[model samples]
Target: MFSYTGGVVLFAAVLHASWNAMLHGNRDRFLSMTWMSIAIGVVSACVVLYLPLPPKAAWPYIVASGLVHIVYNVSLVRSYRRGDLAQAYPIARGSSPMLVTLGAAIFAHEAIGPLHALGIALISGGIMALALQGGRVSRAGALAALTTGVTIAIYTVIDGIGVRLSDGEALTYTAWMFMFYWLMPVIFVAKRGAPALWSPLTETPMAVGSSLAGGLVSIAAYGIVIWAMQAGAMGAVSALRETSVVFAALIGRVFLQEPVSAKRWLACVVVAAGAVCLGL
Candidate 1:
């Protein structure tokens, strides 16, 4: 329905899935994610210099969203460690819209319509299919993926509300949040020191470049999302962005050489369908 914003967010979805594939494929997930965050923060620092600060109303939500994002990263790394990208990626992304739906109904006392129910059903079915795959998804991985979904839902709500409160300064809010989130990673790098952080820079220059590229892609992906949320309904925008689940499954199969079964592919499609339903 939202053609212009839809095209932008679908592009974001592809970029999101691509970077996530890189994260899942990396041997040192935590370090790679941290490096990506550092790169994003560095770039954001420069970007934010020219843009005016987001209005005061958005600051608290920005900080809260940043903190929750840290939790999302930690859970995501753990999920990848414990499961296949095909399994973990779908589970993580698929559950987000459902949770966002449920949270609104429960916490915000919003009534669930037929479309929301249908979307939840589809997402739950997809997740169930993923979980039912014998020896594919670990218990810890499922839990971690669910945790990641929770964080996504929380931050989606926060950002949706926060950006609207920014008085049309969505880019400003996004830059500030990206910069603020890396504060933890900065401390992590400090404690680990230069040798640890710079080791990949010298040993594997390509990995360094990949992480940097992923960071830029990540910034662009989420920046679009933040901006799109300002123009669209929060739930729909979040759901549309989560179409990444399908792209991730394909990337996991092709790029990572992971053995993706037909059923798994179907499940991913179902999850994406659910997300689309939520958007519609």
Candidate 2:
């Protein structure tokens, strides 16, 4: 069994995968991404009002994280545009734990035990396998996913540091970060023009509705992750949280009808094994 924090993060991983897999249902990946961002931002804004502000020490990180998250979302939309959810999502997400581990070590000064190292190595190899899946996901998708992974690593460390420095205001910090980070539909509105962005709302109300649900799930998932980070090493929390890749592989295969090769299944197993090692 996982430790308390590990269990919490594991639950978060499930939620994370659920929402991401749902993301494939939309016709426009950009629209889905934008709508989900808006939905999460709206919810976060409401919650952030009641929550106390994070300490000044955490504000810089909050701002920096917000900037980075924008990049992450944009890259994610691009990756999905060019790839299968299983291939792109795993490559995007599975690569993050190792990056976070390295970032946490250098920036947070966290020590890596042998088990942790082994776990990261396994996860990294699994990600490589997923990325190498032939002709299923485009080169552009892989590149975009790699970019997303980098942003994920950067923000994971930033948020880990931010939330831990919140003086027990982890909830407040997380809420504020999400609220500030997204401001949701604003960027898309600017890009597509307000008319273009909102007009789709009427046509694809289902996508909008599902995206809203996903937004709620996304916030809840990351909220748990930020809370868990307070009690675990940033690297460990990140590694464990990334077990979403396994769930993602399944969701992509079953619901979305994305092909999952035996090789991909083996890779998912390897990733899960790595996650277990990280938990241990």
In Å, residue 143's CA in model 2 sits off its true spot by 1.1
TM-score of each predicted structure versus truth: 0.90, 0.95
Q: Model 2: residues >4 Å from true position, as ranges?
A: 135-137
Candidate 1 collision pairs? none
Best by TM-score: 2
lDDT of 1 by residue, 1-280 (tens): 2478878888999999999987777788877888888888899999999999889889999999888887887788888888878788777877787677666555444455688567666866785575456675667888998888889899888887788889999889999988865765765577687677878888887877788788889989999999997866556666677777677767877899977678877887786677677657
Q: Which digits, one per residue and each the tens of the lDDT, describe model 2 over residues 187-271?
A: 8877888887788778878888898888889889999988887767787787777778888878887898877789888888888
List all candidate RMSDs to the true structure.
Answer: 2.3, 1.6
Candidate 1 TM-score, true structure as reference: 0.90
lDDT of 1: 0.79
Q: Model 2: how far is 166 from its true place, Å?
A: 0.3
Clash count (model 1, backbone only):
0
Best by lDDT: 2
lDDT of each: 0.79, 0.82
